[model samples]
Target: MIEVKEIEKKYGRKKILKGVSFTANKGEITCLIGLNGVGKTTILNAIMALTPINKGQILIDGEPLKEKTFEKITFIPDAITMLPQMKIAEAMEFMKDFYTCWNQDRATELLGFFRLNKDDRISSLSKGNTAKVNLLLGLALDVDYVLMDEPFSGIDMFSREEIANVFTSHLIENRGVIITTHEIGDIEHLIDKVVLIDNGLVTKEFNAEEARENEGKSVIDVMREVYIG
Candidate 1:
């Protein structure tokens, strides 16, 4: 479980996150939704330790996130710009050596499942294929928390659907997954929990099943009201 307590962030005099608090439980997929410039990415960055929080704390599995806890978590950004000249196989091997939880079989399975040729160069693949590679690497890591920032940014609808399916199958059971994306339509069914952020603050958190039953609404509908209503 990851617990974020009263987190705050500011760039110079402008505050980006305002005392946000939430607990992302194990066995749940937590999706963060918000309008552009609402500091959704900032929250992920703070959790990943790429940006320091001005206040509050983030604890992973009851312990604060530190350099030593890196093996327990994995963060995949929207786009990864690895060496363009490297082969797909080469990149996988490099990641295998770096991350302790790297599973070679899992990587190869995803490669085959995605129909990506290992001999192909990263520079030659299409944008959506590149995103598949990024997703595969993160999944193979087998971390407790997989933080994805707009993993479906540039993919087409078909590819996005495929990627979403991969997410459903690869999620480590009893582990937490946090994804930040504007295209909530592709992932409504997969997400177990929703955290709505606006103007750097968490405005709402709802369980998917509960919302559907009690509110008779979809995640996107609730999001429209949360961000606009």
Candidate 2:
């Protein structure tokens, strides 16, 4: 399990995350949902230790992040980190060299799943395909947990559909997943938990299926209450 306890982040005098707390268990899809500029990405960064927190603690499977614990997780940012000149195959090779957890078989499977060509240069792909490559690289890692920052943003609907399908696939089974998104209409059915944020604070955190089964409300219905009221 990944636990974030009373975490806070600040930029200059402005606080971005104000005592945010949440827990994401393995084998469940946990989503951090909020409008843009509301510190959703910052929370993901804090979990990855990519950004420093002002106060509070983050524990991965009960231990703090360090050189050894770092290997247990992976973060896939909104944008691809590879050079445009690099081919898809080359980018996979780059990951292979950098992380011991890189799995070539999974990478190969994802390449085929996304219908992407390994020989194509990163600069030549469309926005949807580019997003696919970015996702492919991260999901290829055999880490225990995966944190994604807006995997469905700014892409074609078909591409978004394809990417969303990966969530239901066995590719992510039995692993902890923390994904951030402002849009949850397409993925509400795919997530186990939703942590709602507003003004850097967690407004609500509830099980998506439970919300429906018990309250007869969709995730968006609850969002309307939080963001509108």
Candidate 3:
């Protein structure tokens, strides 16, 4: 499980996260939802310790994040970081050399799962396939938790659907996932918990299935009430 407790963050005088807290249990997909600059990305960054928090704590599986903890978790940023000139197979090699946790067989499986050719150059791949490669690199890591920032952004609908399918597939089974996106239309069925953030604070947090079963509220239904009412 990934636990974020009362986290506070500041950029100069601007506070980004104000007393934010949430829990993402293993085998569940937790989504952090908000509009632009509402501190959704900041929370992911804080969890990975890419940015320091001002106060409070973040823990993974009951322990605070440490250098060794990185082996147990991986972060897939909003965009790919590798050089665009590299071929897909070469890119996989890069991961193998860099990360001891890289699983070649699993990467090969994901390569097929995404319907991508190993020989295709990154620069020539479609936006959707590029995103798949980015995700595959992270997912191929033998880790327990995955943090994805806007996996569906800037992609075609079919591509977004393909990405969403991975959440339900055996590839990600039993692995904890925390994803961030401004829009929830594509992944409404894939998420287990929704944490809504506004004005740099958590406005609401609820189980998606519970909300529907008990209140007859869809994610958008609840969002409409939170943001509009």
lDDT (C-alpha) at residue 50 in model 1: 90
Task: Please identify model 3 stretches exceeding 4 Å from their true place.
Answer: none
Candidate 3 positional error at 78, Å: 1.1
lDDT winner between 2 and 3, please give it: 2
Candidate 1's displacement at residue 86, Å, is 2.0
lDDT of 1: 0.84
* Highest lDDT model number: 2
Candidate 3: worst-modelled 10 consecutive residues by lDDT: 74-83
Q: Residue-wise lDDT of candidate 1 within 1-229, one digit each (tens)?
A: 8899999998999999999988788779998888778888888888888999899999898888777688889888887646888888898988887878888888888888778898888889898898888887788787788888887787887778788887667445667889897768768888899998888889999998899999898888888787678
Local accuracy by lDDT, each model: 0.84, 0.93, 0.93
Q: How high is the lDDT of residue 137 in model 3?
A: 93
- Candidate 1, position 135, lDDT: 80
- Clash-forming residue pairs, model 1: none
Backbone Cα, N, C clashes tallied per candidate: 0, 0, 0
How many clashes in candidate 1? 0
